[model samples]
Target: MTLVVFLLVPRLHLLDLAGPAQAFSTAADLGHGYELRYVAEHEEVPTAQGVPLRASVQWPALTADDLVIVPGWRGRFAAHARLSKATRAALVAHHASGGTVASVCAGAYALAQAGLLDGRRSTTHHALQDELAARYPATRVQRDVLYVVDDRVVTSAGIASGIDLALHLIAVRHGAADAAKVAREMVVYARRNGDEPQRSAMLRHRGHLSDTVHRAQDLIDARFADRLPLAEIAAACDVSPRTLTRLFSAATGMTPLRYQQTLRLERAENLIAHGSTVDAAARSTGFDDARMLRRLRSRLP
Candidate 1:
């Protein structure tokens, strides 16, 4: 079982802690072999939401495959709040042993305190980005992104973005399909990429609130590499293919078939970047031959 240990601090943001936890828990429910655990310096932890939570002061045994996450806490002055020497040592030791460490929102402060961010790319809640950079010049603090992952250290923008980070980690360790399943279970329409400039074709047109369109997108995401039929997708959403196409176009400025093709093209590009031949990538992404793939590639806009 993979252990996910949450390092709790006083006055932490509730969603920053809970969002990722829920994602992993849902993945566990989907039989992902994930086991969630919590640790805190104090057994009684106070949250920004006025709810007092209890956690074990004792940490569980950890392996490199396990993860330690520090959720963002409530304070812009986190750089000044000193973590215990033991805590810093533990963070350093864990990472040195090849375990992954993640931070959410202002939680990047904790990782910085541990000296883990030195010479590494990371980010935090946009509100804390300037402060984090001012405090630690060695750490590269990025802006305008959901999250940044450098080596085994992952840092996310802010609260809800934690869910994005969690889904990303899931996709990396498992596969896109497993992450998609967890997102589907959570009712998250998409598993956003960490570096989303919000430009990826899969993410670009998901801004609308049409349930029928969303259901169509879900089906397309799950089976984008297949010869997906619009009739089948529309039937799944209980709409006629014509109605589905109109709704999808109205919501996303793209038809359902266009969206599916974009997904396939994106995956095909990734495959080719990873050294797959054009024909191999074409076959892998469900294209009949390289000719169609090449035609689509040449039309990149």
Candidate 2:
């Protein structure tokens, strides 16, 4: 398949372009056929980092291919963010002809602007979640997911998550084995499926809480794998178990046990993703016993 990626200049994140390009390049190197091209509004354009690249085709001259990608944009937080009309029209025409459209991070903003995201559930960098929802009210913005594939439109969270998204596309478009090979060359795990909840620290929503509670929560986070019990946590907070429970619940909107479980689960998922065996993951997350971790995961989803 041919992959024509539109990398808008002065606003595209490097890895958002590199990750998918590397995946597809690896695919072609392994004897599969793939035509890859980096395109822009003009032949030569500068990236956010001031690196200039000459694209194979200009935006106005781009013809449809198997896939069209809009990598994460630079100047994403600007008040008057918008894509050029030509680029928007090209994307609309490409998608209308049944081509796949994908975006990494704030690249979804371009798709949302093009009216392609209408009624589709998607995600971007967590900071932009509210902006996406406000601008494209027709779209359902998913804040906690790593990525979403609504029909042919694939949207992913943040920069590194773009790699995960591309790996998924490679797996689905080619096969699992091909995607695995690409991951091996990149020294990363196989792409996580879209339904996985995002584990990025940047995604958490903050809240107002007492200084004591915040301090207690910080200590808990720092010592998450210490196998600290409820009584220990309460004592650390200089409070009784009953008082600690009430305070923790009021501040975080979850029970202390639930919050700890969430932390453990997020750590376990990270370990699993980083190539740890399930047993190792359980052990690292303070689940010394295999069956205990299995039971916990079974309750998750």
Candidate 3:
């Protein structure tokens, strides 16, 4: 089993800790061999949400397959001040030993303190990006991103971005399909990649209250790479094809097929950027041939 130790600090932002933890827990429930653990310098931990949490002060034996995550906390200066020297040393040693380390939101401060981020590209909560850069000049801070990964060191933007980071880790270890299953179980819209902006396409277009559109989107998101007939989708939603088309187009400013193609394009972009040739990316994302993928990509603005 891979051990995931969350380094707990005072005044923790609940989601920054819970989001990633929940993703991994769900992955474990889905048959991934992950063992989650919590560690803190003190037995009793206080959080900004006014909840007192308890953790083990004892550190566990770690292997290269293990991960140490520092969840973001409230009050940047005060929370960063509480990063104990021992905790910083542990982070450095773990990364030196080839174990992965990550941070969410202002938790990047903790990694910075450990000197793990020196000469690495990282990011944090948007509001804190400037300060994180100012204090850690050796670190290249990426702004307006969900997360950034430099080697085994990962850092994410504020709050819910932690979920994206965790999902990414799951994808890297297992497979994209496995991570998507966990995300579907958690009712996440879709998995966001590190390259995408903080507000990815799958998330940015979900603000509408149209239940029919939302339901269509959920189905489309789940199987975007598959062949989907509009009639089948409309029937599933108890609407005619024309009605589904009109409603979906009005709600999302794109037809259902267009939406699916958009998802395909996004995934294809990620795949190609990761060194997949056009033909391979096309086949992987369910394209009949490379021509369609090329045509779609050529239209990108």
Superposition error at 275 for model 3 (Å): 6.0
Q: 119-194 in candidate 2: lDDT tens per residue?
A: 8988999888898888889999987677887867889888878877776676555434455556657866433434
TM-score of each: 0.79, 0.61, 0.77
lDDT of each: 0.84, 0.70, 0.84
List ranges where model 1 is wrong by over 4 Å: 79-81, 187-205, 229-243, 261-301
lDDT of 3 at 292: 95
The CA lDDT at 244 in model 1 is 92
What's the candidate order when arranged by decreasing lDDT? 3, 1, 2
Clash list (residue pairs), candidate 3 = none
Question: Model 2's lDDT to the true fold?
Answer: 0.70
On TM-score, the stronger of 1 and 2 is 1
The segments of candidate 2 whose C-alpha lies over 4 angstroms from its true place after superposition are: 56-65, 77-81, 190-301
Query: Cα RMSD (Å) per model?
Result: 4.3, 12.3, 4.1
Candidate 3's TM-score: 0.77
Candidate 3 whole-model C-alpha lDDT, 0 to 1: 0.84
Q: Order candidates by TM-score, high to low.
A: 1, 3, 2
